[model samples]
Target: MLQRLKLLEHINPGAAHRNVADSIPPPQLHKMSLPYNKVLVLGATSGIGLAYAEKIVEDGKKAIVVGRRKENLDAFVEKHGKDKAEAITFDITQVGTIPNFVEDITKRHPDLDCVLLNSGIQRGFDFAQPETVDLDVLDLELTTNYIAHVHLTQAFLPHLQKQSKQTALVYTSSGLALVPSVKRLNYCASKAALHHFLLCLREQMKDGPGNVKVIEIFPPAVQTELHDEKHQPDIKNGRQMGMPLDEFTAESWAKLVQGDDQIAVGMADRLFALFENTRQQQFQKMVEMMKGH
Candidate 1:
């Protein structure tokens, strides 16, 4: 545990303050209202997106979950009750179709003010074996993880700005965005791109009368079905290294409602500062050591 903390202490100095259980939202929502009450969660059929939607529903809010599979969407909408949760079966990677899709949603649910860009793909790459690699895979990760979200954001931002109510534009960037992983180079790059994109989006929306708020959730490793069977060994190894999905999501929701603009789950912040500080080199060395181990 000390070893784990050592690698990340530079970024997670406030780790001791992570135990604020009393900060959880009460049954009656006695505190401030969350800006994301009526949110559209992209890639919401599984993993972190689904978890966020479920949490929103549990908080007595509405979530419009967008996914690629109609079957999964149907099942989720059926189980969650149509009132609290709605499903939009659409592939986020289909960036060109998003503008029309957004227009439809704006017409159908004018009250929808938040868009959580949570849909992404995580895939590994080998630079050495360029011939064996499918370069098209790179496109998939970049488009699905970063580019599609940008398209969706652009499509919705204008409408969100016009709304009188508060609006939130949330993003789910990974810990790897800060500290790159050796294997998933493209995935890390995509997430890093998203992190920067969100930063710029926030800056641009700064003078917009506080009606539009941007939030970035930097998540460390968690138990999510983001990877496939080939990545199982790596996933199993990294699974023990992260907080449980339930714990991560619970803390994330509470902190978000508490009005945190940039929320890093558990030890995720520790890694977030790596690129700026000299600790980046130290982190790289640690990564090499881990590979050796």
Candidate 2:
């Protein structure tokens, strides 16, 4: 215990006594309106992102789909109609360009009320055979999944906060975030980091101005192109794995419309419940103790 205390002090000398404010929003405050008519969806070229974009358009809402592939972007716009959907070619891994990109998009579409960050990549790693792990792939996975999302949030937050009506910053995390998959080391770790980041962001936003809601959707391994069968040969027929895209989308969309800030579907729901039941109370106690200090 003494060693642990010393380690904590060494990590951040001033952390224990820092005045941490309560970050919990009231239950009534959470049930705000879903007035997000125009949404900006990152990584909407395919998979879960494209499914969400299609759903948004189907609901008569405007969806601005962003992806790295121009061909895919053009195809989405062509299918959805330009009136209901707009497409932008963007690579989220280009962290340096994110601010300007956000600036341009916000200026062009000032009515954009919601931003959905769903871009991510997954790769398998075996630490036992360290030689098989590609460091480049590992870095890219982390960047695409977690780092880029943080940058995008920072860039768009100011604009979202300026809106008079309710606005949202939505994230598509995974059930693996709560209960990690051992083989997909970086993928699971990135999601875990993102989950914690969302928690901190919510607390900070609770104390800030404007109604910029932070919503998170936790998906169980849905039928998507996230897993690369070509590269990760062990995972065959990747797209056929996990929950069906339509089923997951239907359930998640329902929860989103019902104003659930944290939407966990299927297996993710159970994992979320188990994790939160044990950890949330302890987290609240820690927060209270810090504030008292």
Candidate 3:
């Protein structure tokens, strides 16, 4: 009877590794296909977005970089040359105009296959101090960081979905989603929501024609214009902030070319590993740390 019980246990549905094999999705086979010869990068004025655009052009891919600043866009076009790169002025927060803008872009560049939604803003706030946290500023941050991204994705989805092959939606999220930071409530919330949205979208597209690939980039604090110049001294004293702009770009470009779904840079990669190893413990620790700051 004992021997029979052992045999039954092996056949039970609750057996540990029984469901594991079924749960695994087949690995994507066609990895080398470049979604398109041309790509669109939003928020190309500065920071990681601009850096990425430059890398794309350097790799000999035609990249159209968009930003709100006309002069900055023109400068990028001039520096990169009209053949390899183009620049357009766009404000993603202007939701009403997004559909028209997307239509115009698609008409002009019918071959465009990849869209990178990389525009975002970060602001520190003291929820406890009303004077320090302006409602309008908070609202703007949320709108630009989260709402604009969702709208732009929606506007471009049909175009992306209709593509023949290798189409992708790439988003610039943050490490804050994995671990919370103090005084950045709005930024953290926006990034966390974006991360969840992308994850759900990825799952939904699983059984489809592999028409759309969702990629998320989680970067740690980087040396950029996001912080106030006046607060440079304070930031320097606190901790080692992000890496140099060029260095970060180089690493990010190499990873993207290799077709990584999730790219974590610098110390941010450590946070990713921590979450995978001890999700509950790390989450609690993060909550505790945020409460004190």
- Highest TM-score scorer: 2
TM-score of each: 0.79, 0.86, 0.79
- Sorted on TM-score, best first, the list reads 2, 1, 3
| Local distance difference test, candidate 1 | 0.80
* Residue pair clashes in candidate 2: none
lDDT of 2 by residue, 77-128 (tens): 9998899999999999999999999999999999999999999989999999
lDDT of each model, Cα atoms only?
Answer: 0.80, 0.89, 0.81
C-alpha lDDT of residue 241 in model 3: 56
Q: Candidates sorted by lDDT, descending order?
A: 2, 3, 1
Point out the worst 10-residue segment of candidate 2 by lDDT.
25-34
Off by over 4 Å in 1: 1-33, 230-241, 272-293
lDDT tens digits, residue span 80-182, model 3: 8999989899998888999999999999998889999999887777878788768888888898889999998888888878887878899999888777788
Pick the lDDT winner. 2
RMSD of each: 15.0, 19.4, 14.3
lDDT of candidate 1 over 159-272, digit per residue (tens) = 899988788889998877777888889899999889877766776787885478999998888777765545534555454556778888988888898999888875577755
- Candidate 2: where are CA atoms >4 Å away? 1-34
Alpha carbon lDDT at 148, candidate 3: 90
What is the alpha-carbon RMSD of candidate 3 to the true structure? 14.3
- The alpha-carbon deviation from the true structure for residue 141 of candidate 2, after best TM-score superposition, in angstroms, is 0.3
